[model samples]
Target: MRRLGVWIRAKITLSVLFSLMVFFIFLVTVVITGVLFFLAHFFGLINDEIAKGGIVLPIIILISCILIGTTISGFASRRMVKSIREFIEATKQLAAGDFSTRLYLKSPPEYRILSENFNRMAEELGGIEILRTDFVNNFSHEFKTPIVSIKGFAEILKHDDLSREERDEYLDIVIEESARLASLASNVLELSKIETQTILTDKQMVNVGEQIRQCVLLLAAKIEKKHLDLELNLYDYSLSGSKELLNQVWLNLLDNAIKFTPEHGTITIEMKRPAGLLEMVFRNTGSGIDPEAVPRIFDKFYQADTSHSAAGNGLGLTIVQQIVSLHGGTIVCESEPDQSEPDQATAFIITLPSETSK
Candidate 1:
């Protein structure tokens, strides 16, 4: 047998029709019939008048019930109509880039829930708009800086009487600027790819500790340049996840730690499984991040060190946070300022549920 389906509009209409039928056809008919019979008995016309006016009484009652039911249904359905019209208007405004528009529904519980959800969606859209604007502005500025440097140095290298040292220095400056531009482009592309990925497709049993160790070793040159003391206390723990994505997380965190750690500072990488959760911490001793800047550190294009002296596009931590979220995990940062010891540390602590945990 073939099955049929009623859509939302048809269902709503059918519901209103059913309600009207119950009130007007069934309940109204029964009440009016009882009233007419009582009146016939009260006026001492039960036998003769009942037999003569039985059909007439029912016709009059049915007409009256239809009129009353139409009036009440009109009022109730009008509210529904008004709510739907308002919802359509709000959606149009949203489509036109008006994120501030919201629906104030005072009609029914279901409509109220829909309005609340619409408002929440509007809020998220507004936030994304802000991020987009910031990205465009910041990207332009970042790209412009390297171009300016390359142009200025290339002009200087045109001098015929320049010394070898001066020529080499200008060439080095151009090279560094070009590398910076390339890095920025790569980071932007990576972020765009990750944002569109809705699921972690490549799952594997990865050695969490070994992956982190490799990330740290990859940045050994930078660590040596800073003369930083490296401490590693990794526990043997494996987890089922996307190794490629998690590797990016560790590399970004370690790179940030190396970038911010002062000369001759201390850096620590610790991993442990506690209560069926894999917790990894990367801590570096240096000028700690401010408490106010902690909340927005994971925001795209957000840099706590805003001096532009840092070798970053402000997307590393943002990528780290996104990758962690994809794994159904959490990442947090904590810092303590130095009073006298000068051993203050800033830490990025990541917690993930271990699949191997019994």
Candidate 2:
């Protein structure tokens, strides 16, 4: 049905152009014939020829011009109609999930531009399709693995032949798996909310430095357990933003730092006003991130640790980025991965407006 509509529109366009050309030819012929007759009557010229031949030459010239003009117009309209048809077909193919659809027009600069943009759109759509497929498969695997573990552990616990120690171990595994499942569900929900949110709620004046300190204090136990050194160089800085969302950013960044840092490793956090923007950096000493992985680090369900050995469900950074962006902020990761030096580390830098009225 849509294809039919497109065909009808193209036909109408061609018809209109052709009709305009024919009308123009007719108008020109009438004006020229009228002028010739006027001049002949005033100067008494061609009157005798007209009386004998009844204006046969003018009539023949008009017919010839109309025919020639109509043929040229038809030829011109054919190329345009062909380009339009190609676009319509490409649109249909794209709608049917063929992201490889591309256009290559040869004539006309305008058509070339359209073709270039169309191909670019198709390429982008193809990339987005791949990402979407990866997201679904990753989400399913991440979601199902914990449930399987929980089920297996639950089954083992139901055995009356098991010893007390074995039962306790199995119970612990089941509990941990259940917690993992809960965390996965919660992260998925938070990501969905942030993805759709375009505005901030519960907006207030949030102390940026204080939030980092609070996050540090909250994770003090982990820091001590890992024997990691915590260094804070926070100066008083505040921003108008969503307090709840920004807190998530700090918690995730600090937690990730603690998770990846080595024993006695240095985790340095510095806050300063740089280029009129409030800048904060969280650096941790470890085998930093891979260069290739840095670009996709914040993508939803993307995890550098593909082994699933980490403590997160891969939604933390994605959520942090969304929250920061909602507050008109930016987050970037800089890491010197696999360095020969012992002090090599990964760092995340975040910047935001100091005081947004919104």
Question: For residues 238-340, could you state the per-residue lDDT of candidate 2 as single tens digits?
Answer: 8888888899999999999999888999899999886658888999998888899999999988888777677788889999999889888899999897777
lDDT of each: 0.83, 0.84
List candidate 2 segments past 4 Å from native: 1-72, 356-358
Write the residue-wise lDDT of candidate 1 on 157-263 in tens digits: 99899999999999999999999999989998999888888888998888988898888779999999999999999866898899999999999999888889889
State every prediction's TM-score relative to the real structure: 0.80, 0.80
Q: What are the clashing pairs of model 1? A: none
| Candidate 2 global lDDT | 0.84
Angstrom error at residue 326, model 2:
2.4
Give candidate 2's TM-score. 0.80
